[model samples]
Target: MGNGLIYVMAVNIVIWIGIAFYLFSLDRKIKKLEREMNDPSH
Candidate 1:
């Protein structure tokens, strides 16, 4: 039972880390697009 709990915790941690990275990258992309839209040369 203890080992199972550890596995669950590890999985959850990994999932959260992945989600955080995905959000970070997504934010960067959105910001870049916004910059492009605001430029007159674009």
Candidate 2:
């Protein structure tokens, strides 16, 4: 039972990390688009 709990926790951590990474990437993309939109030359 202890091992099972540890495994579950590890999986949860991995999932959370993946979610964070995805959000970070999305945020970066949005910032880039915003910069382009704000530029006078665009």
Candidate 3:
């Protein structure tokens, strides 16, 4: 039972980590697009 719980928890942790990375990258891309829009060169 304890081992099964640990595996479940680990899978949850991995999913959350992937989500966090995706969100971070999305934020970075948004910021870059905003900068490009505001820049005179574009």
Whole-model lDDT per candidate: 0.95, 0.95, 0.96
Candidate 3, 1-42: lDDT as tens digits: 687999999999999999999999999999999999899697
Model 1, residue 1: distance off in Å is: 8.6
Structural similarity to truth (TM-score) of each candidate:
0.83, 0.89, 0.90
- 5-37: candidate 1 lDDT, tens digit per residue: 999999999999999999999999999999998
Where's the lowest-lDDT run of ten residues in candidate 3? 1-10
Model 1 off-target regions past 4 Å?
A: none
42 Cα displacement, candidate 1 (Å): 5.0
Clashing pairs in 2: none
Model 2: ten consecutive residues of lowest lDDT: 1-10
lDDT digits (tens) for residues 1-42 of candidate 2: 686899999999999999999999999999999999899587
The local lDDT score (0 to 100) that residue 2 gets in candidate 3 is 89
Model 3 residue 17 lDDT score: 100
**Residue 23 lDDT in candidate 1:** 100
Candidate ranking (TM-score, best to worst) = 3, 2, 1
Residue 29 accuracy (lDDT) in model 1: 100
